[model samples]
Target: MAGAEWESLEQCLEKNLPLADLREVKRILYGKETRELHLPSGAFEAASKGDFELRGYGFEAAEEQQRRPRIVRVGLVQNRTPLPTDTPVVKQVTALHRRIEAITEVAATCGVNIICFQEAWTMPFAFCTRERLPWTEFAESAEDGPTIRFCQELARKHDMVVVSPILERDAEHGDVLWNTAVVISNSGAVLGKTRKNHIPRVGDFNESTYYMEGNLGHPVFQTQFGRIAVNICYGRHHPLNWLMYSINGAEIIFNPSATVGALSESLWPIEARNAAIANHCFTCAINRVGEERFPNEFTSGDGKKAHRDFGYFYGSSYVAAPDGSRTPGLSRNRDGLLVTELDLNLCRQMTGRYKMYARELTEAVKPNYSPNIMKE
Candidate 1:
């Protein structure tokens, strides 16, 4: 099926639903004070013209006697591929650069202190095809790839920290590839990189065919905004993945993902909200929008007919707070930017009293494991 037909089917399915308004659901799940922020008039006009949803929300923090509030605005970008999957790699990269740069410029206007794009935001979602030729060509150096270079320029121009998730081609380590998120500081310095800890083998998500589980453990990058970490895609399903990042001193965690609606839409809002409440840290979950069509057919090993598309991605990208409060997500069908203002002091306030309990519990787990079995 073509992309337009798939989208029309999605619309038909959505119109028959009895689901509540997402904003109302979030307000009830979080508190009444979990309200929206009104952006400048120009921002609204730009979103309307660009055909992308733009929203802003603020998470309030309690008054602290000792420390002042550390406020930072964060932007999350969820977009579709600008070109066809069969496009040349250089042209694909160039088109994506131009597209993301426009969105980043809008984010800068909102005074965003930090920004993040969805998983593999530069290219089409081609892992389903499993072709080693052009798909693997998307993998580039995490340190100085075209994607990172473009992001560096954006970060420097806006003085905003950028979390760029890309397929990485490691030159030093036998040219192995990894699904990685590269952190670029506000000064445009290459801070460090973290690989995806979990690889999904479910359905058409054959990510493990491209790269193995990451070697780098959960390491938090301290930026000018706050101490942040990236939990790429499938890692969001693991509670331990969320816990380890918090244990490593990550105040905010971004899960850059590209999951289809049919497979994991039900669990989308639940996991990140649960993680925020459980870990006592902010969680930002992002997913790309729109349906991507591939040139060849693929199967999910479920006795179903081979298909060319992976269904709709359902881009309801959201930000969950440490106090279980969250902002309403972007639309499921269009490109979007979710701008949220977070007070970093809230993490400390929520987690301060419970830190000892978490530490003790984690320490207690060490003795339960058998020493005879090698750790994974």
Candidate 2:
């Protein structure tokens, strides 16, 4: 904004904004009552008989479809970067390991047919520092990395599909790097993969320094549940990214992201729902929670002093239905699992309140029916 407005905002933050008061307001109004687990950063670890719960918002399918509903219970896991915080290497991976393992076991018992982790989930969002060696060392093989291997076991055990997005180091291909998402099937088979087509240029997200735009275009994978696809983090801003996935016949597209609240909180819930309604597909938006402060300060080239803290990666993960309805978002300041059931036939049948409308429209419009006001 202009100079005066900027000064006013800073003053307001100084005088009126205490972190405690902000949190209290959230607890009363927005933040649902929750019980935090004591394990590292994976407190939102286990899911029992609807412990983390929300009322379903969308409509039910037709009677025929309802009798034999192709309902696939899906889960989205969002968590913070791990212990000995700010330090980006060995400890961080260990923390995520504990977190993912805990959640996977919980989700399987909870009947989640498919589950997805956040983007670059294996490591911190270390690309912000634009440093080498320390962060680059974390990139692992997409084919047989420790991360995918761990997830494969979980998928096989549960008979569920797993989408693990990570920073991939292609050792076989000259150690080149790409932001990739590995899709594993129920039988522990390594299904095909897709990469992040778009990289971010806003603020401290200087990802282009790490890897170029993904070479793998939007590709859909046919799993036992339905046709699925992955739209990695930054691409959520691009509508066509969502379009391409839908165009490729993706019935459910998961957007695994690592964005902060300051950058895109308002836009988060809006864009995904729009994609779902417009494309006639289910959209799952997953983000990492908590802050990962670096040891050193970095400037955003925005005429501001260098700062070590990148704003909080607020996690408000949710699922949107094809009919423009969504469930209540999960916790904003805590790591959590959002599990929701989906009927694949509802996408094809759209048997909600729109049932009669679909039927009427089909009857009203025929192949040769067109505007012929001139009595053609």
Leading candidate by lDDT:
1
lDDT per residue for candidate 1 within 13-85, as digits (tens), equals 4466456664354356555456677788888788777777788999989989998899989999999898888
Tens digits of lDDT, candidate 2, 109-183: 666789999999988887879888688988998889988898899888889999999999989789999999999
lDDT of prediction 1: 0.86
Model 1, residue 349: C-alpha shift (Å)? 7.0
Q: Global lDDT of each model? A: 0.86, 0.77
Give me the candidate number with maximum TM-score. 1
Stretches of candidate 2 off by over 4 Å are 1-59, 64-68, 85-88, 349-376
TM-scores of the models, in the order given: 0.88, 0.78
Compute the lDDT for candidate 2. Answer: 0.77
Q: Can you tell me which runs of candidate 1 are displaced by over 4 Å?
A: 1-27, 349-376
- lDDT for position 111 in model 2: 69
> Candidate 2, residue 21: CA error in Å?
25
